[model samples]
Target: MPSGGSTLNAENSGNHTLPSTLAGVDPLSQFLTGPRAQAAFTLRVTMDPPFAIDVQDQAALTVIAAIQGGAWIIAAGTDPQFLAAGQAATVRGPAPYVVADAPDRAATVVIGPGQSCRTPAGDHVDVTMSHGVRSWGNSPDGDTVLLIGTYQSSAAAGQLAVSALPPLAVFDTQETDPALLGLIEREMSRPAPGQESALDRALDLLLLHLVRASVDRADAAGPSWATGTRDPVVARALEVLHAEPASAWTVAELAKRAHVSRATMASRFQAAVGQPPMTYLAAWRLALAADRLASSTATTAAIAQDVGYSSAFAFSAAFSRAYGVSPTGYRRAAEVS
Candidate 1:
């Protein structure tokens, strides 16, 4: 195996132990409940000079973080973007792109399904370049090093978490999630029990970090979901809604809690969150419902009650309208796909 390289599998990595204190954390608990980051395809690539790889797998999401040296990324329809050490970039995919020593360098290898690789001349290079586990590269000591993680099957909630954002976004050096990075690095090579589970969880946290950072930037490119948090009134309202999605909340009630008049709250919420307060609440409830449906085997009626629907039929209708599929159908599709 190449140094600092390992393929992580949930079954092979062993059972992970979690602290009792972290049991009910909303988003984190939801992420741990299902297929959010279960089978992450991760790799550490080490390369020397004149190296470039074209990624064609087009996974749902691809995250590239620099570890050792700087690299250039040529995203589709975009100019080359340089990633210095300690910086990271996320590419929303199904689109092919190139990562190389320099933006001008052509791809010498193509990464395909199952992470198999082949040269331009149709020569198989998987075994020749395979370092160990999930590691693949030209040399273990190459100056340019990167940690790549791909989410092949994104969970419903995970999708909702990153609903806003363009195809390609980069996190500046200052925004790097160092805590999660350190945990991943520490567990990357441990051949002990539950290492795979630990790695998967770490990777999930890393993805969450990237997604939140993308939204938090709130620039011309930032998503409204993130920018909404910038408004104190809207942020407080959001916290209330997220904390009690099952509550029958009205705009007047939400406004009362936000300490703003109904009219002012409505106007500010619409301005900041890009939607009326009630509309955002409805969407948030549905998003929570989707997460439950995808991650749990609860009855539709039970799930409906948890998300504030009076009847299963009502919940089903709303879910269908929002996701284009019934609760049961969505669950089945999430499992199979």
Candidate 2:
């Protein structure tokens, strides 16, 4: 935990009973439905030393905020973007990123990875961030303070729905759904009343709301490659691929899923999503297989089976074509990271 942040004694805090909507869900599963979120985080920092954190990353994605004291988030491999107070950010894209103070002292509250934040100088601090469907930060720092939240697929749904998030957006918290923010705070900070598990579920609800928010933002912004997202036809096709990448699929199958003619779907989706349907599916499958290979002890062939490849050699060939590196090499690089 950082200097001022500490565990809350939910038992001692005034026992705030849950609202009517949350009564039905287990604290953990509740938020997955887009309602009844329970976990939230709020912090206040006044610069002096910039903060950064690494996400444990079992969860799919996280959103960052500049609700008060401002800071810059430098994506692990991209340029730094400034966030003033009351702004929000979502980085559910490829590689992980970093955040810090330009002048050596900025503050931020992050959720997603259950790790700590670091300064630009490589200084790190332990931070406790919860992940589920929904997580939130309402730090009213008054400078570049950000309100961040996270959303991911269920444990059984591993990286299913969230990978389609559009990376580009107009970073502003005022444009978000007020109900989503308020609900996350209420559930996350709720008095335990003998229910810590309930808090986890509340966080899930907040995450679902975030996905909806992302969709709205995508609709408004139209399309851009930087967001790593697509228009409606492409997004729908993506949903199909994400839902069942392991199943045998083709351009025609994806077109049917999106309710467009195969040729129409092929051209439109490629134009909007930046990859042909088959290419995207193959790449997405290989990407997931690569992650499984890196994160687990699964052998190359077994990993292939899980992601629908017929053999390790076949999978490796496809993976190499997509990633320009062998699966083993990629795993080794990931290990080094």
Candidate 3:
């Protein structure tokens, strides 16, 4: 709850407070927090009709909101999903996709890795198409206007949450908050101090809302962990795990804390979350460790202990097995990137 980025260790863990990153968070919020943005790329695009942009940037996540007109999201082997005015959609990536005025429109600009823009023949158009501050398009007053925010792979924290998304998830007008979308659009147009941080927080909120909507929709396809929060027992168990990940948690302890029999807890957790309680906790701990390794200067041993590993050797073995790289090696590679 502190303004500064201070972490509360196990001694203070009993207070049920945690670092800013994981304090009093829900299951979805804990995972969604992984995509925290830093100087994220935010853009407003105004395009004429019959326009298509071939996106191959391989961003971890992209949020596209239709401000004025609409666009069609065309992914390979899936029906095109349209975002009418006031609607938004999130696209998970590394895979290529297209946003077009119509499904059949040919792409005139190709968005390559690093957010580089070029024609299909590779003629650079990044600067040529710039409309204004954080804006891009073929025309300054194009009929169709869209607000876009992207989280590049390196900046993303929650690998587990990102991995669980469908390639493209659309949120209709009823599912989105117009005020938040307006805030993002307005913020994108302004050049001010701390604007990047402002936009980043707004984008995080947008993603959070979208993911929450997905979970609430019974017919919508969402991660099992997100849907599991609907169950009181599982939600309580998840709250304990997230709030005090460094605790020496056992299934029996979690069951006891949730006021349920161990068997009931285990079976219900598996049924709702698709993983046993202990198994999920292990993955969750490792995920927290991985995020810390990339974002902090903490020693591996410290991070291991913070994530509930008994020893550095044990943490290293488990981390290596899960990530295919030792902690030091992973840290080194993260630095290079």
TM-score of each: 0.82, 0.50, 0.88
For all predictions, the C-alpha RMSD in Å is 7.2, 12.6, 5.6
lDDT of 1 by residue, 116-197 (tens): 6888787888888877765678887889978888876566556655655567777877788766666666665446677666
Provide the lowest-lDDT 10-residue window in model 3: 1-10
lDDT of 3 by residue, 213-266 (tens): 877878655436776788999988988877787776778998999999999899
Candidate 2 local lDDT, 16-41, one digit each (tens): 23223222322122224322212333
- On a 0 to 100 scale, what is the lDDT of residue 203 in model 2? 39
Global lDDT of each model?
0.70, 0.49, 0.77
Name the TM-score of candidate 3.
0.88
In model 1, how large is the Cα lDDT of residue 2? 25
Worst 10 residues of 1 by lDDT: 6-15
lDDT value, residue 307 of candidate 3? 72
Better of 1 and 2 by TM-score: 1
